[model samples]
Target: MRTKIILTATVLIGGAAFAIAQTSHTGHSDGMDHSAHQQEQAMTGAALSEPGQGAFAALSELVRVLEADPNTDWAQVDLAGLRAHLVDMDRLVMDAVVIETDLPDGISAIATGDADTIATLRRMVPAHAAQLARDDRWTVDATETNDGIELRVTSEIPAVVARIKGLGFFGLMASQDHHREHHFMMAQGKDAHGH
Candidate 1:
């Protein structure tokens, strides 16, 4: 009988403490609504959503697009190929060195780099030349060299000639708005940029 009475008293005290805690936290006793605290956290939380790097941001964007699309083939997804292409782009931009010479209308560039960079240039420059050739205003060509790649751009339009010369090799390489669509196509396992 004595043990049962002590157990009942302990249970009553515990329940009362729990009820008080609930009332205070729920804004019934302390008069501050916890809902406001939750709203503040939602408004000013320190958890950022950035991917924190360029290539990663690009990949994440592609992932989001793929996830949102019902027609995306999960089996055919080729993010690794896309990443390799991104690395090639990085090498071309960051590592390749170019010497420019005057052409009648535009410019010629002897683009050279380390072996890996040269390899990247070999893969990219000709493909870019093909893309530029599609424009009627410009003539573009790239040739493989023993050490690097040679690229020439010429245009009959005087203003365009000036622009092409101003752009030179790297800028011309970076030119055109086809990259995003090409990346999308590549992620979809399509022959974007002809490879």
Candidate 2:
């Protein structure tokens, strides 16, 4: 019964979000801006949620979350930063090139791309490497090379080593679940990477 209720709620919310997208999406050319806030205001039947695109959906969700919070300082809110970060994420996943070297216990790679992708990679990999380093299961290192960013990840446990090797650099980057919190903070004009 509880499962059915949860599933029903999910379906209803999804339907509402779709209706909102069909009604509201204008096919903007660039990143999401303050228009998301306007979209938030334009909601109908409390059904308007999640814009058509992934980044827009994420931004809109945060806008809703922040707006609902009692202490949110609108003056300090910086959805632009979050939008920029989301663009960086797209670049990292879609554009960056990973040159992998398989290791006995793990893997190493020099992640490279065009100028913009390289810049995003340099900023992102090291920060995430720092995050990965804190985990006892793996030893992670990221260093800047002339052409790209070099990532080395290894593990002490045999099972973990196999997992690390399988994950490789890109998968390793996707391992830690920090992007959501970082997005919220970035949207609030704060640097989660402190960079």
Candidate 3:
């Protein structure tokens, strides 16, 4: 069972990685050169950016190269940085919880909890979706509920669901409740201060 789960998770991660590859900005004829832009970013190392932007950018570039040539030299890739980024992602996942509902064609997951917890989900889900959107694997919609806010994530791919589930502390609460009542819990690695 564990092996099966790991295999499934691997497939999902690969699918999501492919989505990232497709969305990465390459040099296009529209006068927008992603390569040049990426270079600029590397040179500047801009601050005050989103939490995982740099890691996401690195993964995006790596995906782009791998897609272009599957046989590319592994030595050229930043394995350490990639590992660090994934660790960061795991940490973030460990700190949050998601309530999942199985829809007819897809899945709907809502982050439920206290005001601050909901707010954290509000911030993280879209940002995560935005990163995934670059790969075209997920679409995110938000609605204001009596509790706080609910994120409606829709994806046609089963791998997307699998990927979301693979995130730690995610998919803990599964319900058919489209009625929108918030029930929050503090996931592992989160303190009483909500940090």
lDDT of 1 at 181: 92
> Which candidate ranks first by TM-score, i.e. highest?
1
**Pairing residues by index, what is the TM-score of model 3?**
0.33
In Å, residue 89's CA in model 3 sits off its true spot by 8.8
Q: Rank the candidates by lDDT, best first.
A: 1, 2, 3
Tens digits of lDDT, candidate 1, 1-195:
999999999999999999999876775466667577668768997554666577788899999999999989999999999999989988899999989998989999999999999999999999888887888899898999999999999989999999999898988988886889989999988898664
lDDT of each residue in 24-104, candidate 3, tens digit only: 744355578656767888899964334256546545555565558766555644445444434444444555455667654
lDDT tens readout by residue for model 2, 1-195: 999999999999999999999766664544557667677777743555557889889998999999899999899899987888889888999999998998887889889999999999988899999988888988888999998899999887999899888888778989889889888888888879853
Ten consecutive residues with minimal summed lDDT in candidate 1?
46-55
Better of 2 and 3 by lDDT: 2
What is the lDDT, from 0 to 100, of the residue 8 in candidate 2?
Answer: 100
Give the best candidate by lDDT: 1
Show the colliding residue pairs in model 1.
Answer: none
In order, the Cα lDDT scores of the candidates are 0.89, 0.86, 0.50
Candidate 2 residue 135 C-alpha distance from true site, Å: 0.8
Report clash pairs, candidate 2.
Answer: none
Give the higher-TM-score candidate: 2 or 3: 2
